[model samples]
Target: MIKEQGEGKSRYMPGLDGLRAISVLAVIAYHMNVSWAPGGLLGVAVFFTLSGYLITDQLVAQWQTAKRIDFAGFWMRRIRRLMPAMFVMLAVVGAWLLLFDPERLASLQGDFVSVSLYFNNWWLIFHQVSYFESFGPPSPLGHLWSIAIEEQFYLIWPILLTVLLRFTKQRGKLMMFILLGAAASTVAMAMIYVPGSDPSRVYYGTDTRAFALLIGAALAVAWPSRSLSAAISDKSRLVFDILGGAGLLAIVWLIWKTNEYDSLLYNGGLALFSVLTAVVTAVLAHPASRVAKAMGCRPLRWIGVRSYSLYLWHFPVIILMNPSGIADDVHAGRALVQIALSLLLAALSWTCIEEPIRRGFRSPFREKIQGWSPFQYRNKRAVSALALMLFLISGYSSLNADRPADPSPAIIDTSSNGQEGTTLPVTDPGIPAVVIPEAPIPMEPQPKSEESSKPATNAGITAIGDSVLLDAAPHLEKLLPGIMIDGKVGRQMYQALDVVDQLKAEGKLGDRIVIELGTNGAFSSKQLRELLSSLQDARKIVLINTRVPRKWQDTVNSTLEEVANEYANTEIMDWYSASKNKQTYFADDGVHLKREGAESYAFLLSKTLQGG
Candidate 1:
């Protein structure tokens, strides 16, 4: 997330920062858990390309100057520019968690070291951490995966460039080599990506993502920022603007259109986005481009200048502020506050740490510090005190790496738990039922209540669902005696229709059916509608909403509510709402249940059934 343009042979390009501004904002939008920008995560690929171009341009300039790379000096320069702000952010985060959230602090142990060493991406990969899945108390350093990938590139690309330079003096040759490498990486991503499974592996892998960086490197070789001419004819300028504007528009479109799970993304979609980013970068770096002038406007440039620190601080701000880590609902006012705070902290980090360190640690206000007014003096003191606190936190966090976290007792089924349930009693109101072209299915007798309706006891209640149902199966069984359950892992709503059909065929489908299917992921109304249509003949149907950490949780719940409304025999169990803010009941991932959670969930379902 560091600034693209560094202090080297390259001059400052404000347009490039504007691009960073947009990219980082997109990343923030994705994390904001909003639906509109599902593809906002692609912004990181833009950053990858931008970094590749700038770093390669700088390295090429250095090689042209001395005919040899100064590895130590280059590495030191990178460390100076990037490390201070990161250390400050991590330290501050560590201290906050240490004092108020000891469990989170203890959980951060391995993450702290991996981030410091810039190996967080691989660490997450080795651990198989799911980036898109909801795990409560999410790692504040989770977003640092991209930062780790970029840092790895920054370290290795320079050495590789030096080696490539010795083989050929031609930029064409260099461009060809980088493009080939990018192709190989893209192929690897496609090969590794498993449809309908978590894509975190390919998403976090440097080998798979190298194409984005390589695309930028290739662009720099073909069109170095320094080599572009200041004087350009109007005709060429029009071409630059058209190509640049179109490329930028395409990027924004992708940000709006796609999401992380789209199968094509790993195959070629991401590679295409990177190539477009390089086009925009090329146009912005050109002196003749008006697109660059527009993007370099003051507000955009200002944000661009501090994009790195903004990136570093934003994720932690979002995570810590909403520690429950349920991102399904959009809280606009809260989001605004989070955005404002992130900007404020980013500005502070940029002013106090990044700019000062990179520019040789000289304070611009040294002379004024001696003759400051009361307000200014207080401000300086506050800043200094904050800096001291951050310094102390970093050191303290290091010493307490092995400190034990405070223990938390598991939540008892105090009041009980669960999401969605029991609709009004079904009567003579006619609703179109789904037709099954099969012989009459046999069903065992169901015991009736004194009111002449089927009882809610387990004997006649059939529960069909995914892993969440299995997690709570013991309690469901205990709460309702002889409840028939058919739950499997990784099941979705689309699969439910067939399961329902099979149950009906085998005379296993009960008049009272409780389904908890969407926990694995999302489902369309078409899928839910089809499932509900088949169950229209049932005496009662309970559609349990999910509490998954995935972005699709909202989709699953909303579709259930909407489709359930159309069926007279249906009711939605607001399980997600009941379980909200009750992470103590859940396991670490927040999707599956602990013993307490399962018991509570079962109790809630029992109440819904008795009442229905």
Candidate 2:
């Protein structure tokens, strides 16, 4: 979407603004967890390419015309344009967390500092935090990592371009250097990426992700569109048409084909998508291109022009609007409200902060008077009032929200005979109607002689599990007293073997053992079989199946049932069945338990143990 101009410079292209609209919308849809846009995070790659093209276009023009770059002016403009709105967002979020969600404040303290310093990606990587994994509640500012990457690019790229220009004026050599940088970045990403593990490190690394930006730069140097467009014939125009359409379709197809779980994405899929985006950009850059005209429609261009503000505001707005997070009731109405509010905030930020700052405010009163057309003024005031009312309503609703009273479950160590921490009664909805047994099941006494004895007492019960198990540990202990519970966050099935061995060595291994693994990741039939072998020494083993919204849920449940059937000492606790339609019992993830869900989970386990 390059504008046709002479004098060694490109003018503003409306179609490029439209492309920004598409990219920002994709990112917003992804963050909203829309089912259709599973690969919407690819929007970041689009932004990287666009940033590369625009910045290089400006720098190349300066190098060719002025024979030097205005480094101070360029850095100042970037800081003024991007930092003000970002600072406002961070400040608002910090206040919100302090006022409404104090628990998340400590975790986000580092986020604030890192994001402010433009190295948040490295901070997350150093902490070994996966972007996809939520250890607790997610930070609203998590998306700032991409901004950090762009800022880092801005920091180093202009000086590098100046050096390149000083060394040689040949665009061919410049293009080669950019290509080599892109290639090296791609190789670095592939080298560090491990299949089947979290790809956060590769995804967040600046050295790895710089390829997308470099690829865009390479495209600019290789195909300066004003020159290429004049050389094209009618037959070549047809080729451009096909290439443009094909490139767009390829992006949509890849978005549908790949998901966060796809291992190939880190290996080469991202690089492929970036290349495809560059191709589409090249097509749009041509002045005679019809695809550019089509995408340059007014509505898309409007969104594109204000995209930076929208991107900055949309994520926090979504997070704040969801009073209960993924657990809260979600409908089209709430979604509409979220979209409207995001747009309003973006429009306000553009008018109030970005535009005025960009103009340098020679005289605020005269500018405000000049800017105030009757209709525009009324519309701005009306939207501001609406936004204020909505914020107040949101604050009231959040303040009076009926959150579960029980704190998150404490981590328990398997090395000792540890009882669970204190648990309060679930306060969301009253306890569901549970058929409590006439009395707690009486423990049978153990036989001193070699003869067979009745099944071991409830005192000889031990439970091992992941975060879900941790959520229910206190309730499980309260329901089945004296039971030893060992649970931790993000525990996987293979880790269970080690836990079992540890329990056995400590002589705390129980006859009736509850295994609540497989919530974090999928395990194979072979792994299940091996785990079953480890538990064979127990009198009876209970396998708790999962209800997570992940792709592996059915495989995990079926594998557990199949293995439980093969072993007479094993039985399945069908948590998936019991938790169906009981959305109030769980958090947004549908895997971890809230207070109501934790209580229900404990009741289900207790009932299963008591022959319910």
Candidate 3:
């Protein structure tokens, strides 16, 4: 996907670029928060396999012709194709952040250095940055993790292949070696994956992801593109087309049906998908496959040709220019505009930068300008290079300049009656906020009956929740005296049942229950249902939805909305609606409450619980 195969039609496989088009499109769709493609993240895995196949094929071709891999030339070719667009992107994103949002710029230097060095994936992993757990504005360069993986493979695989070929020239044995490596990688991923934790460790690790690349490399070793002949029986061609088409359909299904967080994806599911992509790659490489002909149509080829540039530019455009505040989930019109901007930038980069550098910067106008010599050009470029570098350095330094911290968090008295408050600071550390003003309103769908069985006061009310509830506890107590509140830091939905059961046994289970969990991460609908069932004896239940700015923000709120609709006495208290876009009510980290937010939260819950 990074660069097209230069081999003529019998071997070049534009259908593979067709595959590139599909893969890149899937990734872009995922970034755009399109409803149809939850598994669009799998698109990166597809590109990994495609890259392994193409790069290995190119290397094998060189080996067949020259009897050795040209390590220097191969690496240079890679740099020329990949480096130009990326460096330009870095300079532009850096400058943009410097001028507009400098708070983020302080931390971006690491990302810049990691990307420049092609170790961004490792940087994220080692730094304990969770890819799925992002809360604030995401690093626009975050998607470069895949590029780092591919570049690492490009750097090492050729040398490794040389050693392997030197070890045993037999293709069968070579494939076996590569396949064994792939198996080890798959097993490592499965073994390392913890069911409920952030899967970023395995997701970003080079060793765990090597299986996809190795699968493609094995395919290339077993079926070199150069050796495939145009002469084939019609029956064989039909078989190729049918199998290839089926593989493509299956890939599409997985992209649509699956999600990144599903447990099965880590266990063995991704390996299976990688194998399917390789099969599709294999069929597309065959000379007589009609599937390849159809896939290589003009529109698909055009997109495929610019796929790498598109991939490079899409994420940045979305992060920088998104209209809606939910970060990834944009409205359709805004999504389309952002996508079009991405394409425009990609096309420009491909035409002006990527192609020119890869083709040795040979200008079409070189012939027109008489006496314009390479020597003169080099001298002028050298003189200008210092000034350009210094200008860039000065801008980069300004972006890194220290800024003032906000005034210390507001002093809200979290004390009420004889009960001591949880007195912790309400400011959640390092959680950036991208608040969406249009987040869902509370679902108080007409209750089956007009029964007004609301609690008169906090007499029989019990509030059980996470740190957010803790933040607002003092206000809740002040607003509704004698309301029993139980809250702890980082409490998730699963921990609520035990607390509730303990309270019941202690003769403290209130007839009115207010549950506010799932702020830490997403919980299953089953968990929510079980919690509701346990509180069935309560006269009224108020479900507080979350305002977590992380990826799970929508999931937590939606599941609460969905599950609350099923219960008769349950009603949602839309804290997210009250809090979104009111940044002054929040600490530096957007998710937590300042005094105003806590007071508002307490008042809202009081109103919702008392049937105001």
Q: Per-prediction TM-score, please?
A: 0.73, 0.75, 0.75
Per-residue lDDT tens digits for candidate 1, residues 267-303, read: 8889988988999999999877999989888778778
> Which is the better candidate, 1 or 2, if ranked by lDDT?
1
For model 1, the superposed segments whose C-alpha errors exceed 4 Å read 1-8, 323-329, 366-378, 383-464, 471-484, 488-515, 522-550, 555-612
CA RMSD of each candidate after superposition: 10.4, 7.6, 9.0
Q: Please write out the lDDT profile of model 3 over residues 118-197, one tens digit for every residue.
A: 99999988876667755445788999999999999999999999898888888899999999999999999999986544
lDDT of 3 at 473: 74
Worst 10 residues of 3 by lDDT: 410-419
- After superposing candidate 2, which stretches have Cα over 4 Å from the reference? 1-8, 95-107, 225-231, 325-330, 361-382, 395-452, 455-465, 469-488, 493-518, 521-545, 549-574, 583-612
RMSD of 2: 7.6
| Pairs clashing within candidate 3 | none
Rate residue 407 of model 1 by lDDT.
Answer: 28
**Poorest lDDT segment (10 consecutive residues) of candidate 1:** 412-421
Whole-structure CA lDDT of model 1:
0.76
In candidate 2, the residue pairs with backbone N, CA or C atoms under 3 Å apart (3 or more residues apart, or in different chains) clash, namely 1-284, 1-285, 585-597
